[model samples]
Target chain A: MEYLSMLPGPTNVPNRVMRAMLAPIINHRSDDFVELYTDVVDKTQQVFQTKNDIVALSASGTGAVEASVINIVKKGDKIIIPVNGEFSGRLAELIEAQGAHVVKLQTPPGQNATFDQVKEAFDNNKDVKAFYVVHNETSTGTMVNYLDRISDLTSRNDSMYIVDSVSILGGVNLPVDKWNIDVCMTGAQKAIAAPPGISPISVSPKAKKYMIANPPPTMYFNLARYFKYYEESKHTPFTPALPLLYAYREALSIMLEEGLEHVFKRHKVCSDALYSSLSAIGLTPFAKQEDRSISIIALNYLDGLEDKIFRDTLADKFKVLVAGGFGNLKGKVFRVGCMGEVNKYHVMRTVSAISSTLAMMGYKTDAQAGLKTAEEKLKAL
Target chain B: MEYLSMLPGPTNVPNRVMRAMLAPIINHRSDDFVELYTDVVDKTQQVFQTKNDIVALSASGTGAVEASVINIVKKGDKIIIPVNGEFSGRLAELIEAQGAHVVKLQTPPGQNATFDQVKEAFDNNKDVKAFYVVHNETSTGTMVNYLDRISDLTSRNDSMYIVDSVSILGGVNLPVDKWNIDVCMTGAQKAIAAPPGISPISVSPKAKKYMIANPPPTMYFNLARYFKYYEESKHTPFTPALPLLYAYREALSIMLEEGLEHVFKRHKVCSDALYSSLSAIGLTPFAKQEDRSISIIALNYLDGLEDKIFRDTLADKFKVLVAGGFGNLKGKVFRVGCMGEVNKYHVMRTVSAISSTLAMMGYKTDAQAGLKTAEEKLKAL
Candidate 1:
């Protein structure tokens, strides 16, 4: 089967990036390698949209999140987190693991935490050291206005703002510097158009101050040592995934050449086309229309249709892989990602495939009309 | 200039494996992925020569080593470790980080702890929970007779025998069952012919018993969880690196088809050829002859000749990478790896490159003669 990965992670990797990852592994100590590492770091700062100290760790996204927690929050620190989606809830668990107290601002599954709620929590808890939130929740297709609300909350309290932009980073217009985000970190798999191995983290000076003041006595995720090593030697504390770094350098080059604004615009257009097609097929979106993420669009199945059957038909027949609604909404919706290299053509094909698959699975829908409407919307762009 | 990476790891990745690794990013949950991971694990067991529970991790070698330490050793366990080379010392450090006390049996560099020494240490330390040692110390090019020693140590002591085979697995024969090695683990980059990311680890029933009795409180590196997941679902605790696992499957297929015995003999031939050429060129092998590893050859340079300059000449002129010594042996010795996919032909080419580069630097050797001797040695096979 000709399979296309429309899943949230391990997204469509570019051919050039694939080749770059395949390139011969070079000696890490070589001068050529140091130059490569330095170039990647500089380019990463541009992608992150921040002048903060960006350190690349050869770990999964979860590892970087753990590093953020371990570096800034020592034992018994009070941290504020949200329990909106899976990733946010994961942060709460990580905070708990660090032996820290967590004050969770709970919102409904599809809804995001409001600034007023966050403010109330902050006002109630003066000992909070940091605020952790996900900018775009992958489990739900809700895009929080992190820069507008969370930044205000953290700035008012003088606490560190740690944002996980993992699924939305490269595809969204996240001006990290303009937003005053203290710690913005991302994984490579989602909008980065690369393999899932490395995590890119940009630490604000304020966050760095907090990290240095309370450096975790850990070894693998030692942020202070990582900063020293990257700044002084352009290397990591241990042997990194060298091939993945090469892949990142290539992926970043392509991303920068396309410009961040163009990438963001593309994601919005593709996602809009997908949403339009779903609407044409009489399917409602899971999240509020205004808060739908540009990179991922979640479509709720009609009353009689099952999401698993719809997804299985798409995968087994059309070979278009997409994300199933996670957790509470498990069989209710399917998510189609328009991030990274996913463009208008892909969006149209996905819409057509879903429409046809739904029809084959005994759901009433004019499959061609969904595809035609999607194409028209995309062409009007 | 030709360059050689002789420093322990990020060892030379073969072009075939690198090309294999250049595949498109794959979805970890896909059924196609199940086949890849199963193949990788099955082949890894073949390399370890055991039917133990083998699991692959999407982290560096140290990360897996950390997994071993945290999985087996709880907070108050005592470990008996051989502190001969840098890697074994690292094992002790990892164990100590778990709040365990290490009883070290120290041996000098270029030497291995004798069986009597290990047994005596275990005999003296009645509370020892585990005994850790590196089968091949890449830092010192010293290969121990761990197989002959581990069986007696663990069979009677009721203690785990954990072998760090990071630099030696697949390059040498590791009979885990015959050797009674409770746990044997290795990384991808060393002699596995794959780029580094995943660490392959196999554990025996005895090690499983220890884990069941004392489970580490950590969630990430939980071995029992991994075993449950693999035994029941044939999956990992978290999302595994699909691409690296694919590379491992292919590399292992090649290794097995080539025959393990043939592969070991080839490594011996390459190592001996390189060692002979170094001797002919008036350089001394760093490791004692009786205990020298057949995978990596460490050579001492002539007095007053900086090892970096010689390494630079090799890299710049020949496009070959040799390793420079680390820590105490820096600037004094160069390491030439004969491990993994490296064969006699590669050794001949490297030896010729070394002799030619040295001759140009006025080191007085017939480059063509050294090349001829190395070629003759290979032709004899």
Candidate 2:
């Protein structure tokens, strides 16, 4: 069956982006390859809004996340982590695997932890060496405003702040430099509209200083080795996916031409339309309006409806795919992604598809109401 | 200037394969995606010549290597790895990261670790858990005949045999079942003619028994988690690159249609012709004849000339890109690849390009003689 991807990642890669990704692969050591790689690094810097060394590694985003945890936190060191989403909780698990201790602050799904809670945890844990948080929680469409609060906490405690902007880097503005974020890493699959392989990690001077003091836990993820490899030869520690690197350079150029502000605005508009349409059909959003994600919308499914059935129906009947709630809110909420190449037309079509599919499934809802509401919202934009 | 890839993966992706790679990205949870992933896994099993659990990962081959080492070896387990090529040496480094001791066996470049040397080391290190080796050493173009020797060694000793066929899987015969290999892994970009992301790794029942006895290393590369994730969900440990996965299915289908024996024969023919042409130009091959790679040919530059100039000339004047010597052989040897779509015509064209380009650079070489000899070799095919 023909399918439309509205999942968080492996998001809809535009045809142009896919063509760019399919460009002929080049030899990594060649002069032409060096030029291409250097340009890609620069483009990533422009998008990241940071001048820190943006080292790209040939692995999944989880690999980079492990690198962040393994590099900064040494054995027996204390780390502060949040357990609100699956990804964040997984971060803590990785840290524990390194033989480090993680003190986690637990919160319910779709609920944002306040700065006070983080500060209290920091104040209570005197041996903490680093604090990690996810900027945008993909499991639940909740946005955490850590950039504004993390600097104060880290400055007061003299600890490193590792921010994960994997799903929100290009779709939203989280200036790494201005926020005093010690280390920020992102994946290419989500907002960059590129096939996943390379994850760009920017290490602040502070983070490098931390690495200098503490040895890296994993040899492959060592920042010192990365610096030597990239700074000396503009190559990775291992053989990189050359075609994916070329495709990223092309994807970054397209992002720059579109402008980050335009990208942010597009995401916001689509998300707002989705929220308005869902609410008009008598469904509530899982996240608070103020904390809702501009890249994704989490909908609270109506009473007596199982989410697996709903998600399957959307895929089987409407050919539109959406993510069901994971972890805590499984079968309670549905997530539709509006990030990267998701336009107003695509939003309207999705709303139409979902509304009709819901009606066919005998869910009590006004099918016309959602589409009308989405179109009206798009028209206002 | 248009660049050509001659390095071992990511190799030059053909237009047909690239177009297949450019296919639309689908939602990871969609049935279409599951079907695509299942097809890719099934096709990969066919290539690996095994009914074992063939799983695909969304990372580079090194990550797969890391996964294999970390999943199978416990904290204090002993590993015996050949230090023949750069990649096999990397296996030692990865084993060390897990706090395991590596019983290293020295095998210099342009040579393979003799079965006697490995067996002696295994005999000495009675507590050794696994013997790690690279099937095709792309660094030196030396292919080890491990299948015949390792089967006997593993039967005699209490150790598993893990093979890295990253550069040789499709181009060479690696009958995993017949070889009784415990763990074997390969990447797609080399001979599979697809972009790199997905790495196919198969673990035999013997390997699983060892893993169950040992503790899990890291969460990210946990084989138990990977098996559970795929067996239960039919997806990966994470969101995989949908387009690349689909392209791999297509590439595998093409490979199966061509037949494995025919594929290996074509690679052998091209490599022999290219090696003969290089020898005719007064360049000695880097790898020993007894253990030479059928897909990749390693040749030393003539009489102590800088290898960079000849490599640059070939890329600039002829647009025929060949890999430079890696690791210790850098600037001493040039590597000509004969894998993936490289046939008799490719060998002739590459020989003509290399001989003519070198002749123009004042190297006392006969361009016509090399091409004529290479043409005769191709006609014999």
Name the candidate that leads on TM-score: 2
lDDT of 2 at B249: 81
For candidate 1, the lDDT comes to: 0.78
- Model 1, docking class: acceptable
lDDT of 2 by residue, A31-115 (tens): 7668988898899989988898888876667777877877776678888887777887788788887788889888887787788
Instruction: Give the distance in Å from residue B183's predicted Cα in candidate 2 to where it truly belongs.
Output: 1.0
Looking at candidate 2 chain A, the ten consecutive residues that score lowest on lDDT are: A212-221
A1-381: candidate 1 lDDT, tens digit per residue: 456877877788888888887666777767878988889899999998889998887777777777777787666888888787877877787778778888988877778877778889989987678888888888888888646566776777878888888888998888889888888888887898878888889999888877777665346666877787777777776777888888888999999999888888887777878888888887888887666777778778788787667777898899899877776878888777777888876787788788788778777887777787788878745
Model 2 ranges with Cα > 4 A deviation: A1-3, A212-220, A367-372, B1-5, B212-217
| TM-score computed on alpha carbons, candidate 1 | 0.94
**Cα shift from native, residue B171, model 2 (Å):** 1.4
TM-score on B-chain, cand. 1? 0.93
